[model samples]
Target: MATGTGIGTEIQISDSSDEQVILKTKMIKLDTHNWVQWSCQMENYLTARRYDDLFMPPSEETKRSSKFRQKNSSALALLWGCVSSELEGVLLDNKTSFYDTWEVLGNICGKNSIVTICETFYELISLKYKPESSLQAHIHSFQKLCARYNSITSDKVLKATFPPKLLAATFIRSLNGDKELTGLVQTLYDIKPFTPAAVISRVAIEHSRRQPNEQALFAGSSNKSMQKTKWDEQKQRNKGQRSGKKYDKPGPSDKNDSDKRMDNIKKMLEKLQASMKPQSAHLTTESNIKTVVPTLMLS
Candidate 1:
């Protein structure tokens, strides 16, 4: 029967053997604390089904847009070098947040679209995204920084954080040398106020540089991706399947669940004391250190 959109519990599993042996089985439900788990599971499902719904072909526009979408500093530096310095201007001005002390500036204004937002002191992320808007709507803030830096600096974008795969992609692109992007090499370092579109162009150029010998970049990208994924997988394993708790370590909930908690040594002492023959066990000085004095001297 169709249990509908939400998860339905009481899933059943059955096991049977020959000779009339029967046993009850248990059910399993899947959910995680965050969307990452949901996304990974969804990807696994799609891969298993061989679904081709969302495969996007590489496009100049998409490539150009990727700088802003680039992974954070760790991956960006390995992929691009110091040529990505223009990223400094892309700094997030977060003076606002409910949970945080600073407030967030909410505008999608670009150096290109200076007409819309009149604010002179800070940059804005618009707190929202729109396709027709000057800035990219859904792109992550850091990814755009790479694009903005690359665009203004051209092909010469240096990055503080780099991913080896991005370098591999760039190295492969270098083989073709479309010289049309000749100026791009210089612009990545251009430390001037620029727009989101400039960022997109830089990213496109970077990807184009790899398009010539796509195979190597592809392989490098794939291997590096796998390595990265492996690292992430290792991280998830650490997260979901951490090493069993140490003998002395207590879980976060242990403080609240004191009633269910056990003092192994105390329990053992009680068992030993109860099992011992009358007065068979005598407390020594070392054991007496923890002994309780029941009587008090007269004041």
Candidate 2:
């Protein structure tokens, strides 16, 4: 069956094998965060397989052709497989052509309105690093938000307000005062062409260094505390020994020497008393003889 020509030139399907080959090739599924990239990839895949014409309306000659309807249905089925389940429900009741469906999906997920773009831009600028979240993950999320906002907005707006320098500055300002990250951001701003990717890489490296450095510091403090405790204990033990030595009393041998000194003083006093008694006896006998001789002379 012959199909009608569309916006792109009519692709004459001469062989069934080529159709099967195109059908067999898997397409990348779309997600909310990656719609822009996914759409680009889908366009490239459709163009490469010469099936892009299926997305456009048929020409006048093929408007009533059954073969054109069959071709559109096949292309729609393939497109359905490439979308996520969340988007499937939105497009399920859509009775439009493949091109209309594609546009609808883009509008829904792409958020092409100026308000949406501005909101996304504000969110990117306001994105802050959470202590519980990973630093690298936060940086990556901000980068993706910036990319999406840039894709939606015009180059003039981006250049005037959200330039690369401003993006880098915003990212640096959102950090939660990590010294390594702050220093790296400062270095990045000092250099020419402030690239966000460089800042992300430096942040990852700094995060890795910070973990080990913090661990080492903690271990060092623990060791110092333990050493201090041991030193204090030793000082107390030495002090107790010195106190015991300073107030220590004498033993049994010292008591025996003191008793021996008291006994020697008593023996010396007894010897002097015994010698004085012999002299006293001689003087008494001499006095009695003198008294008797005086009585005889008087008679």
Candidate 3:
């Protein structure tokens, strides 16, 4: 039997031709969330099968053989199966060459934006282990995010000036409080050329060796509940302030002062209107007298 790794699993093929080989491989479907890793795996699989040539347009001079056509059709079907339902709709009417299909999918799924890549990198770097989750699960999540970041950034020129130890230390610092694991990670970081894989392996071993503590788990849960309670209280306080019910509620003195200001504004407007009315009356009377005096002089 020969063993080989494909995608996310190990496959063992029987040496005997008569024996049926059971292929074990995980189907990594392409979706918006996992396009990067899916594209990487598909590229690897295609390159391994020498089907990468299908990515180029067929030359006019080249005559297609029946065997080549069959293989190409089969490859297309396999590629279609790997795509998600939404992508399948996009590719439904596509009956063209594999290269055309590949290009279409690339255009649709390949974000390749520098801003998107930076956001993904930031998310990976800022990943924190949830208190409710296991150490192994958290590590797996970190690895997946790291893989995604790497796939998105594979084309970009990254700065490798930082030492491996520094990288490992940074990752350890991001992890939640696990004193024993943190100490182990520090010790591993002290050794030069500490790779992420090495740190992961050591952490896994240490995690497995340590027994589960009911008390610690309970304490973590309690802390989470306490945090949630505090958040709820803060949220309620914010709501009260927004509604002007609690923090910003008007006091008796403030209400009286506001009423006094309004009254003063009203009195000022009344006085101004009274003064304008008298001036209007005086102007009208003076105009009437001038007209009467002109009539008397004419007579």
TM-score of 1: 0.16
Cα lDDT of model 2 by residue, 1-299, tens digit: 22323322222322243555423333456656556667766777667666677667668676466766665665566555677778887567664467667877877776355556666777887888876457768877887887777666644643424666777778877885554455566676665556676666677786777678778999999999999998896666556645753213334434664366445644644554466777564533445544644343244
After superposition, the stretches of candidate 1 with alpha carbons farther than 4 Å from their true spots are 1-259, 264-268, 283-299
- Candidate 1 local lDDT, 1-299, one digit each (tens): 01122242221111121325322222122221112222233334333433222223334454454332231221122111111223322233321111111011112213222232222102222222332222222234435434443332232332233343443333223322344444654564352334434544564555556556666877888999899997895565445424533323334444543333334434656677778877666752335424522111011
lDDT of each: 0.34, 0.62, 0.62
Off by over 4 Å in 2: 1-15, 19-49, 55-58, 61-71, 79-96, 108-111, 154-161, 177-188, 211-299
Cα RMSD (Å) per model? 28.3, 24.8, 21.4
Task: List the lowest-lDDT window of 10 residues for candidate 1.
Answer: 97-106
Candidate 2: worst-modelled 10 consecutive residues by lDDT: 6-15
TM-score of each: 0.16, 0.49, 0.50
Model 3 clash pairs are none
- Encode model 3's per-residue lDDT on 273-295: one tens digit a residue: 56786656453354555454434
Candidate 3 has an lDDT of 0.62
Ranked by lDDT, the better of candidates 1 and 3 is 3
Q: What lDDT, from 0 to 1, does candidate 2 have?
A: 0.62
lDDT of 2 at 291: 61
